[model samples]
Target: MPRELVDYRDSEEALRASEARLHEAQAVGRMGDWELDRDTGSMSWSPQLFRLFERSSALGTPDLNEALGYYSLESVELTRAAFWAAIDTGNRRELEQTVLLPSGAERYHATTIVPVKDGSGRVCKLYGTTQDITERKLAEQELRRKTYEIEDLYQNAPCGYYSLDANGLIIRINDTQLRWQGYEREEVVGRMHAAELFSPASRALFGQVFRTFKRMGVLHNMDMELLRKDGSILNVLMSSTAIFDAQGNFVASRTVLSDNTDRKQLELERTAHATRLADLSRHMVDVQENERRKFASALHDHTSPNLAALQLTLTNLARALPPAALPGLQPLLDDAQALLLDTTSGIRDICTNLRPATLDYAGLIPAVQDYAQQFRLRTGIEVHLDTADFTMQLPSNVQSLLFRIAQEALTNCAKHARARNIRIHLSNRDTRLVMRIADDGVGFDPHHLGEAGTTSPGIGLITMRERAEFAGGRFSLRSHPQSGTEIKVTFDVGRSGVLRPARRASDFANGTTLPTGTQ
Candidate 1:
């Protein structure tokens, strides 16, 4: 053979090799190439194209019928119609469809058919590409389904939810949030943001939270105030998270808010009620103290003085009688003397009941001693009083309350205990004033006694507890049937003894117990 003929043969071999390599590359990419002859009504496909259609064999020249048989019935008809339409219109067509392989596995494909024309400007051949897009199509379908599900959740969520852009502009909001604000979706969507829903005072706070969330990625359970469209304030418990893009740049904020207005209102009302109850209790105590002072003053001033003058007159009359005549009149004198003594004693007892003079003149210890003496004299209970490790003068009110508590305890013991010795102890230790009253007599269960003025109608223990509490103290009592009773009260003397301004004489005359030295 000539050298030129040999060279031509080698170039032809090289072109064939290059075509084989192109086919190999298309197969690797999961793509197939095809060509059609319009006049001859014949088609040809690369090996990859035959494989994509799941054909077991590729004959000399394939026809449209062979390709249609590879597609599902529905897809075959649609694809055929679209192919003919593109051919007649001289336009390109792209389609996606599913076809069952010979092995019975379903495959997804994308086909793009392009028309080729002869010099006469008439269609003669068609070229096309097909790609196996099963993975990509399945992924796209899954993404669409998830998007719909998320939209449903946003529309029907129970709590309000919203998203705001970096500029605080409202980007999206849930239907629940719109309803809570008394607005329709069209009214506020993309038109307002977090700041728009905040009261003036809360706007600044909202800004601070937004900035913080942007840096921190999440803000949890923040309590905030919001202004509704109706110009009412709503309390909300809010939580938010900052959204970030693929590059980790802050994009927007997603927040969930729950209404707490009702709970907040209940808490506020409870606080107000507690404050009012405290004020009323103080007022009642003030009134009670005033009444006690007035009664005490009346007993000491008017009643006692009149009884003393009467005794003086009787004494003068008794002394003026002659010594011999005095014997005959001695019985009358003795009666008058006894009557005066009884009247004076009655006056003193009445005065003590209203306000014990020893409590005002001395202190708690002396007053308790005087109380024990009076109790012993009255009930023959053989009372004893003891004090230790105490030197400071207590506030007059504390002294008065302690003395009253002692008085009530002794009275209860006298009426109910029925048996023997009573002991009263007042001492100070570790900055606390401790008072204990114990009776060795018949005792009743302490728990069985209900509150003051309840079924028991007894205020002895209740009064002591109240007084102790008023003085920042704790009160406790222990007793059992026939086991005797013991009452103990402890007060932080230094804390409760802060001196308040003294009240006046008229205040005391109006039944108020003005501070003893305040006069």
Candidate 2:
């Protein structure tokens, strides 16, 4: 073959290879090219453009009017406006269009139109490039929708939210918090400090804790009160966490505030209810005691005197009887006198047990002494009194309450304690008065104690506790099987009534036989 013929063949092969590379590049980019004849108002499309629209290339390219039918109405108007603007100004413009394909599928395309000018700089023909960007466009729409939803949630969350800079200056705040404080967003962010949002006490605590928070990176469930625009307080539970930079420097903080009003009100109501209940119990105890006092007085003042009179009359009758009928009548008169004397003595004991008069007349010390003396004589149990570092006048009610407790304790000790020796100690401290009753006997579990006024074994321990507590005192019992039982009751005398110091009797420590002194 001649040299010219070989060179011609090589050039033809190079042109085909270049065209193959161009087609591969366009296919990879999902791009196609187009041009519009300015003078003839005609259009031309590349093979890739036809494929993107799901159409065959055998048919001639569509005109502007025919192509508009493939686009949605909104896209048609946008394309029309952009086309005319570019044609008149000789400028390049880009537009996105949604096109309906012949295969009944919808697709997105981004198109760029460049105007071609003539020698006189007048716009003539147009060259353009179109890309099949359906996948990218759908992805963008999904991302935009999700972004809007997240922004909405952040702005209108249930609890208050805010962000502060390292210096405690407010930087970002959500709409919910702005509404809570009755302030506009602009008024808080960039203008207010986080400390200014809290009440004075809460602010001080926040300042102290915030330093530690920046170091620890977290703080939670701190109680605080925020001041609203109207200067009203809003109790809230605040939690915070700090954000640090890569170098471990504090950068920002995010905080959440939840209202704690309901819980606070509930606590206050519970406290008030307990106070009312305590007062009612005390009143009922007082009413019961008053009735006992009146009944005891009636027996002492009237019944005792009447019984004495009957006995005296019976004695006189015996003395005045004649010598003739003296033997027969004397026996009957003696029986009547004996019965009257017994009735009188029973009435006196009843009055003393019902409500000891010494408790009201002398004081708690004398009243307890008298009861202890009677208890020892009646039960044949050794009783000891310990009154150390105490000498003062107590309120009548207190004296009565203590005496009753002593009575009940002694009765229990005699019946159940099987005790050989019992001890009673009374003392006064700064603002409290303490009394203890202990027994050297087989002790029982304190938890199994029975009703106060019941006929059960223990001496109305329940009754003793009720009396002590109703008088604003505390009651405690300590015991274990085989050890010993000790009862301790304390009264806040300084709070209950006048508690003054009395000059101590130096010789009062000398153990005396009488119950009035230590034994």
Candidate 3:
């Protein structure tokens, strides 16, 4: 034979081998082949097909009825109808049905049937394959059940769940979060970034928090405010963790959000209540001081002058008496004068205590000077008042508050410190008024004085602090056992001064000029 003829023969043999291998491959894949002879009305099944029907090849070719009987009753009817329909219409059909094997085990098989027509256009045969698809069907059913479970959890979970991409874009959200925002899931998911759900100020804070989270891997209990679709803000306690890929690069984040609006509202309400209480306290102190001033004025104007006049009248009457009568009345007159003098002095002292007259007679400096003089005269403890750079004309209320604070400090020092010498310094600098009172006295522990059951109860100090705070000033006291005590108070000059910014020191100090409204 020639070379071409020999090559052609070899190719034909190779083609036959390939076809055989293809058939073997199909059988190995649990696919059974079948064919039908139209003229004989006989069906031929491969060995695997016979096994698929739970029968041996000893039964040989089966009739259509025999093949139908191998399927369940319902499957049998369905398959028979489909087979005949395909044969009559020349249409192909593929379907899955269950069959009972000889071992009584039920098996699922997928069958494909193709119709063949003869030269006369009459259906002659059907050929197709049947595959064992039981495992695939079971796996598909399991997957569908798990998918439903996951969806149910996402829809009904109590906490808000959300996922954001690396750019803070919202990728996924659960029904809980959508409901919180008064929105449907479709309204926001994949349509907005997480930052978009926040107010402008909150967005800036969120950006910083997000960067921190990215660097830290997780951020817990981050308090933030989120804006809803309706433009209302919600306080939320949120926690989130960054999701990373296998390579450890951040990909997205998962966040859990809880509504804390009620808690935030409660906190705001508490702050408001505190402010109201503080205001009430300040108003009470003002009222008390006004009452004291009224009482002090009445005592000075009505009581002290009456007592002095009574003493003078008694002295003139005693001098006019006879010598013998004078001796008898002298003791009485002397006692009357002493009592009158005592009454006048007591009234003056009470008046000063109620509202120091020096405060009105002179400026704060002269008032402090008079107080120091009186204190030293009474206690024999030397007190020095140093007032410089104190030219501002302060509001009367501020002046009263400062005076009361100084009075309280001096009284406390006298009673508790048992000091010999005291120094008070008042100055104005850098738009602020500063006052310091120091004593070379036996000092007690400030902490102990503030505590319960300690020597020298700190009621006076507490009162002083409250007074200073009411005046919009700061107060602090420093003292330790065997150490000298120091009390300092500072107030903003702009707030304390009654005069305008343009007022000069001479206008206030020299009394040459009055404030804008004063005569």
Best-first order by TM-score: 2, 3, 1
Candidate RMSDs in Å, in order, are 11.8, 8.7, 11.5
Better model by lDDT, 1 or 3? 3
Error of 1 at 14 (Å): 34
Residue pairs clashing, model 1: 290-511, 290-512, 294-511
**Which has the better lDDT: candidate 1, or candidate 2?**
2
Candidate that scores best on TM-score:
2
Query: Which window of ten consecutive residues has the lowest lDDT sum in model 3?
Result: 510-519
Stretches off by above 4 angstroms in model 2 are 1-31, 35-51, 54-63, 99-108, 116-127, 132-151, 203-218, 243-252, 311-354, 377-429, 432-437, 445-477, 487-519
lDDT of 1 by residue, 1-519 (tens): 999999999999999999889888888878998888877667888888877776656355468777777789888987887778778988998998888887888889898989888898777788899999988988999999999999988877777888888777888888887777877876776887778877887787877767777888998877777787898888888898998988888989888988888878987776555445534544565576568767888768887777788878878887898887888998987898798789788878887787777766787777778778887888889888877656657767667767878888888788777868988888876556778888898776555665364334145666666555544455667777788888887766555464221222222232211111101
Q: What lDDT does the true structure give each of the candidates?
A: 0.75, 0.79, 0.77
TM-score of 1: 0.52
| Model 2, position 282: C-alpha lDDT score | 58
Model 1, CA-based lDDT? 0.75
Q: Cα miss at 309, model 2 (Å)?
A: 3.9
